[model samples]
Every structure is written in C-alpha cells, then in structure tokens.
Target: MVDNRVNPTSNMKLLLYNQVDGRCPFCGKNLHYVKNQIQTLLEIAHIYPANPKSHEAELLKDVPRLSEDVNSMENLIVACRDCHKKFDHPRTAEDYYRWYDLKKELMLNDEAKSAFFDNNVEEDIIKVMDSLLKIECESDLVQLSLSALKLDEKINKENSFIFRKKIRDQVVDYYPMVREQFNELDAISPYQFEKIATQVKGCYLTLIKINENQEAVFRMLVAWLDEKTGKISSLACEIIISFFIQNCEVFS
Candidate 1:
C-alpha cells in the first residue's frame, strides 16, 4: 500500500484546488457562513474514501489522481455548511443513489460527471471494462477457439463443449454489440484473423495504458535493489534504468 500522508506535486495541487477563500466548490458558499469560525470552516472532502472498509459508512473513496495525503488540496473539495451537514449522517444505499441522480441532473458539469462515475464504479472497475474490451476485439479465431477449448478441458474434460458454451455466453452477455462484430469475422480467413488480432491488441493497450502501476512497481524494485550490494546488484539496477528509458522511447 502507498503511504497516505505526503502531498502530491505542488503543480498538481494548484490545478485541482481553488486559490481564493476555498469555499464550497459547487456554489462558492462561504467557508465561515454562520459564525465565520475557522475549525467549523470547510473541510477537504476526499473524493474517494481511502479506507474501503469504512467507505460504506462514510461514502467516500480514494481518488487515484489525488495525492497520497487524503486531505491535500487535490483531494479536498470545500462543501458549504448545508451540504456538509447533510453528509454527516450516512444515507441509505437507495437514498445515496437517488441523491446522486438528482445532483447529476442539476449539475451536468465535468466535475459532477466525474464524481458520479467515481462513486458508482467505486472499485477499480476500469480494469474490468478494459478486459471486456479486449475480449470483444480479439481475433485469431482458430487460436482463440483452441485456447478456449483447452481451458474448458482443464476445468471439465467430460463437458468441454458445455464449458466452451459457458465462456461464449459470458462474452455475449458482457458485450452484446461486440458479439455481432465477432460473428462477422467468422466469414474471414484464419490468417486474416491472426493479423487483425495483433493489431487489436496493440490498439487496446494504447487506449488504457496502466503507466502509474508500472512506475510504482519499478520504484519498489529500485528500493529493494538499494538495500542489497555487489557488482551484479549494481548491474541489475542499470538494466532496470535502461528498461525505463526504452519504455519512454515510444513517446520520442
């Protein structure tokens, strides 16, 4: 898990946070509306609740784009006295959705849309979306079909065909539109399917590159290397450094 106390880069903080008075972001409601109190003033609302377990009770989730410090400028959203009071008591699941629907209807801004999606798809649901997209665009019909059959055989060789049908059923249910596109590919040549498969995979990776996770993994590896010694250890670090350079080469 990442340390949750450090503020993100200064440049990013300014981009997300209000510069003046930092009152309620939506309506610009004064921070000290009633008594002009400092402590009772606005508090930073963590867009995504950091603690998932406490999230159901609190109705907040950690926003990946925000800094590690949950209260940092990037994570903070100033809400007015009225809005803050309403969120104090947890709303029911139905009520929460209803409230979100009304809020979304009233404010069709970018922030509202982002907040709505962030709360609804609370988890790392984007990964599931990406996986479904990949399945839809997959070609190499012969190879794909063979691989599916092999997987089914491993699960239950006695009912391999039935298992295969289950996989196909899942794909159709996940992407009904893609199912039609996939059926059209059946008339194409097997070699063409293989070529298209390679292209589609490349396109999919480009669409949603998980560079942040890759960077975190690399950073952790470097930290591990620093704790070790020997010429080979130094050489290993050199290779990792080179890998990063090559990884960024595509941008050049």
Candidate 2:
C-alpha cells in the first residue's frame, strides 16, 4: 500500500521523480502510476508560483508552512493528479513528503552523495561570506549591495553606483589581496548550509527596511534586474504598500 501522507501538487511530481523513490506519493500509484511500467509517472510543480503576487513578505517570514519557505525540504512533495485540479499556482503540499523516505534511504549513489556534500559546503561558505560582507557594508545604504557584488563582473563601472559604491580606501583598496582571501576561504571552509535559510530570512527583513521609504530608488534598482529575477518578494511589496496606506500624510 502506498503511503497517503505526502501532498501531491504537480510540482511535487518533478521533485518525486528526481528526488523521491518508489510509489506515487499522492495516490497509491507507485509502479502502477508508471506508464507501460517502463517509465515512472511524475511531474514537478511550484505551489505558490501561480499566486506569487498574492504572497506577503511577512507571511513568508512567519509561516514556515507557506510555499515561500524556500529553506525547508518539506515545502515540496510528489503528486499524480495531472487532472485533479485545485489551486492553480501549486504552492501547498497537503500530503507531506514522508513517502520519499524509502528513496532517500535506498538510493546508494556514491558520486551523487559526494557532490551533494560538496555543494552543501560551498553554500555554507557563501552564506558566511555574505554575512561578513553585509556587516562590512551595512552603512553603504544600498539594499541589494551584496547581491550586486555577485554581479560585479557584469556591472558597468559607470552605472554601478546606483547600487554599490566603488571602494578605494584602506585595506579594502588592496583589491587583489581581498579577492585572494575570499577565494582561499571559499576553497578551504566547508559550507554550513543549515544556516543559509536563517540568513535568507534576515536578508528579506533588511530588504523590507531599505525599500520602505524609497520607492523611486527601489523601483529603479529593480529596473536593472532581469524580468525573471527582478521582482522582490511579494511579502516585501506588501509591506511597502501597507506603509504607504498607513502613512499617506508623509508622502503629501
């Protein structure tokens, strides 16, 4: 009998096929769900991708249950109802992900395992470096400065000041030395991925504060981003709109 615990939004199908092992997680249709018994039946669908505009940032910050909770593995699951229509955006997993335990347990992939471990370490190091950079630039007055740093290679020196200011003073002025240290640290330290989620939440909060009273600047900044990646968290947008609603006098 297939376990009836995991939620089966279309998004979970891809996750299950790629990430899970055995049985249809939503319906009791594991090998049976596989068409011709030759290929597995499944698909991956994002639960909240449809209604992303409706998501408020604060809700994402508080309710770990929300599909916006990018940190937890539980945010996604496997489902087989290609026809069982419900919410269109496919955010919530009503079934839960316990059905895939067998897959995680039985799959013995030495190379994949090594790569996964290495990636986790890389993520952890990136998170720490990000935190350190945040502290260093807290007074820089740019909301997405750290994320901007990731785009340094692509930044046009003439227009880059809209986000991060150019630095040419003190120890940081020795750009090569600073780059060397960061590269060395990235090479040596194992990433603490477990902490990344917490950092993301914190960064979201910072993003909110920075955007609150600076609509023009915020909008301009977002304009530079690619359409697919430029949108701020719906949660952040909600907070920004709410502030204006509550303090219309300040704008006047």
Candidate 3:
C-alpha cells in the first residue's frame, strides 16, 4: 500500500537533511542533497511509512502503538536517491535502524566540532569587545593576536601529559612567542585579559612579533568561521564574553 500522497514541507525537508548530515545514512552519499545543491536529490525516508497497512509496517509491528507518530522528526531521515529506494524496500527496517544510530553519534561529534571550529564564537567575541570597549577592531583578531598564547594553555589542560608536551611543541613552533608569559589569556573576563595582556605582556610580549605561522593560525580561524555552520547563539556569545570576563590565569 504505497500511498503516494506523502508531501513534506520545504522546511521539514531541510531540517531532515541537516539532521542526517546531508547524506544517505546507509550509503552515506551526499549526491545532489548538498546544502547548496541546485536541485534536491534527497527523499524523505520514513521509518514508519504513512500507511500503517503498507508492507513496511509489517516490520514495525514491534513498535508501540502510542509511540507512533508517522510525521515526527524521529521517524524520518533523509536519503539519497538510490538509498531511498533501498530503504523503501520491504525487510530493510533493521539495517536502516543501525545507520540511524550511527547518524546520531556522528551528529553529536559534528556538534562538538562546530563548537570548536565552525561556530563563530571568536568573531562574536570580537564584535562584543569592540562594542563594549567602544574601540574599533584592529588588525589583531581574537584568533590573530592573543589566542596564540591561549592555545597552548587550552591544549595543555585538555591533553594528557605526553600529549600535552607534543601539542605545546607544535604551538611554540607555530606562534613562537618570546616567552610563555601570556598563558592566562582566557583565564578570566575579556576586560581583565585585556588589562593583563596590554598592561603586562604588552611590554615584553610585544617585543616578539607575530610570525607568518601565527598569521596563518589567524587565517585558519577566520576560514573556519566562514566555512562552518553559522555563528553560535546569543547565549553562547554571552558565555564567551563571561568566560573572557571571569577567567583568570596566573602565568602572567
């Protein structure tokens, strides 16, 4: 009983594609379903096809009756053209479920990476500081200038002992600061960080200029914000501002 009346709104279709990472869960192909694809190549695959009496429903007999929401986001996933056909085939429910679980894990990690790279946390921080301090942003971006110092500290605390040393070595080579004097950049509020870096490190750290490598780091951060998902939420912006304000590092 393939009911041909299923129609999903454009918005719901986009939401499903994003949730599925714009790929077929089974074949993991983006095909024409890419974000900017001229024409959508994805089809909405329902775990429980609209008509409960359809052949696909036979496999979902184990699903609780009350839990069934045929149109719910939980019951739908986006699939590439070929995968969609295979998914609609009877007796493939179990296989699709496995891919769905994997998609969830993949999306979770995607979110974490977004928080680190794609989310424009750094740029938003700059806009905030500029407005709050009433100063126009200069050439030195959040990532371009002091994050060079903050990187080592974040890596050290986040990594293991041996791992920490290896990462620190990379940062040293990348930015090559004169001394590791500005390690506490993100330890407190941005105001305090500015106070310390400007008042204290400005005297000594400025002596060691930014090398090509540090500039490259700055470009990388900029590109990430540009290429990745849009900037973080208003709440995230506030959190970063507060982190800049409340954080304190004694490495001075």
- Which candidate has the highest TM-score of all? 3
lDDT of 3 by residue, 105-211 (tens): 65576565554442233443444433434424533223224444354543325335664453344333322221112233344333333443232223223322543
On residues 111-177, what C-alpha lDDT tens digit does candidate 1 reach at each position? 6445433422212222223333455343522222333222322223443465346534433333333
Please give the range of 10 consecutive residues that has the lowest summed lDDT in model 2: 243-252
RMSD of each: 20.5, 19.8, 12.9
Which scores better on TM-score, 1 or 3?
3
Candidate 2 C-alpha lDDT tens digits along 26-82: 455663343556664444433323224344333333333333353223444444555
> In what order do the candidates fall by lDDT, top score first?
3, 1, 2
What is the alpha-carbon lDDT for the whole of candidate 1?
A: 0.39
lDDT of 2 at 141: 28
Error of 2 at 1 (Å): 40
Error of model 3, residue 132, in angstroms: 7.0
Q: What is the TM-score of each candidate against the true structure?
A: 0.24, 0.24, 0.43
Model 3: residues >4 Å from true position, as ranges?
Answer: 1-6, 18-22, 28-30, 33-40, 54-58, 63-68, 113-212, 215-252
**Model 1 compared with the native: what TM-score?**
0.24
